[model samples]
Target: MRSFVYARPETIDGAVSEMTAEPGAAYLAGGTTQVDLMKDEVLRPVRLVDITRLPLREVWSDGDALVVGALVSMEELAGHPVVTERLPLLREALLMGATPQLRHMATMGGNLLQRTRCRYFRDPSVPCNKREPGAGCGAIDGFHRTHAVLGTSAHCIATHPSDAAVALLALGAEVRVRGGEGERVVPLTDFYRLPGSTPHVETVLEHGELITHLEIPLLPRGARSGYLKVRDRASYEFALASVAAALVVEDGTIRRAHLALGGLGTVPWRVPRAEELLRDAAPGEESFAAAADAALAGAVARPDNGFKIELGRRAVVRMLSTLAKES
Candidate 1:
């Protein structure tokens, strides 16, 4: 790893200022993903500003939302009483993301800011538009079985690998960030940038903006939500196809349905077409199948990963069915 200066500012403003002063400096929270990239020489930040000591670990309920401080550890958030009681889907997603030991060190902000797990981007030897813009993409006709099928561009096709963010997208969560100008709250769905002509730009955050907290607006009291992940193994591997589905059923039909797909898109894929199909439809095989089909309507799968189209559909169908049964 390259040598870099380290700083642990006592205040958020100070930390932000330090990062703003050095555009190449990276804000370090749990040091999980950032550390790995540094060792690989893929990311050579001239400085590392530690934000662990900052008082950003608070997790509580606001008037009608769940406010999660950015520095809150994944383990703590997943096991928090409020999370288990009000957001079981979030708990399940966090627990499924990483092993116990890693979860203890992974922070909320870090997870959301986690980089894509595309092999081309990770292996500095290979060319990746995301890693080095305009260098060319090696995964175009290379090993793309685990790459994205949605929100992909000619420059890049990398799948987002955040389980918590996918659940948050379905739950309609927003992130509060402290930037150079001021503080702002951005919806999770809009925070990530698509790999368009400029695949290097990943998120909407400015150079030194710090994510302060995440807010999940209150959900219906009796709504049923769950996450289903399909992977190559049962261990803490990345998701091949995952679905976070929340459904509110009244009488015998669906009242409101929220669906987000992961491991199949460039971001937390919110399937509005699928939600439109299940908004007022009855909970059954036919409706669920239709919703699943709508979710994959725009999927353009690569040759090796064409199976993901069907696999992603099945995941959505299964999650909706499970939520329907529970509701």
Candidate 2:
């Protein structure tokens, strides 16, 4: 690993300042993902600004929404009373993301900002557009079974590997960021950038911008929500296809539904067409299958990963069916 200067900032402004002062500086919270990248030489920062000391670890309910500080650990969030009672989908996603040890150390902001788990991107020896722009993506035609099918580009096919992020996207979470220019609130849907041409640019966050907190709008009183993950293993593995779903069933008819997919797209994939199809429809196999089809309508898959298209549809149907039955 490359040696770098380290600074522990007590304030958000101090952290941002420290990051901006050095062009090759990165903010460190849990260091779960950052440390791994640094060890792999995939990310070589000249300076590391430790923001764990910053006062961004609170998790509270604000009016009808939940406001979670960026530094809150995944394990803590998963077990928090407010989260369990109000946002069960988020809790389930958090718990299923990693092992207990990793969940204890992974922070909310860090999870959302974590890079893709593509082998080509993580290994310095391989060419990856996300790791080094214009070098070419080695996974495009080589061992891309775990890569993305939706929101993919000719330059990159890496899947965004955050289960929590998929739940947050379905919940309509908003991110609060503080940077050199000051503070701003960005919708989670708009936070991620598609890997069209500039695959290296992943998010809307500018250099030295620090995510402070996340605001998730609470579900309706009668709404039921859950998360389902399918992977190679039962535990401590990334999802091959996952679904985060919330449904409000009133008098045997679905009134509102929100669905987001993970492990199948370049970003946390939200399917509005599927959600729309579920609205006012009865919770049955026909409706569920139709919604699933709508969700995977524009998916483009490669040879190895084409199964994900069907798997993603089944996940959507299964999650919605379960939530509908519970509601």
Candidate 1 worst ten-residue window by lDDT: 318-327
Question: Tens digits of per-residue lDDT for model 1 on 1-327?
Answer: 999999999999999999999989999998888899999999999989999999999988899899999999999999998788778789899999999999999999999999989999999999999999999999989999988889999999999999999999998999999978989999988999999978889899999999999998766789898889999998999999999888889999899999999999988899888899998899999999999999988888888989999999899888888887883
RMSD of each: 0.9, 0.8
Location of the lowest summed lDDT over 10 successive residues in candidate 2: 318-327
TM-score, cand. 1:
0.98
TM-score of 2: 0.99
Candidates' TM-scores? Answer: 0.98, 0.99
The Cα local distance difference test for each model comes to 0.92, 0.93
Backbone clash pairs for candidate 2 read: none
Model 1: runs farther than 4 Å from truth?
none
lDDT leader? 2
Segments in model 2 whose C-alpha atoms lie over 4 Å from true places: none
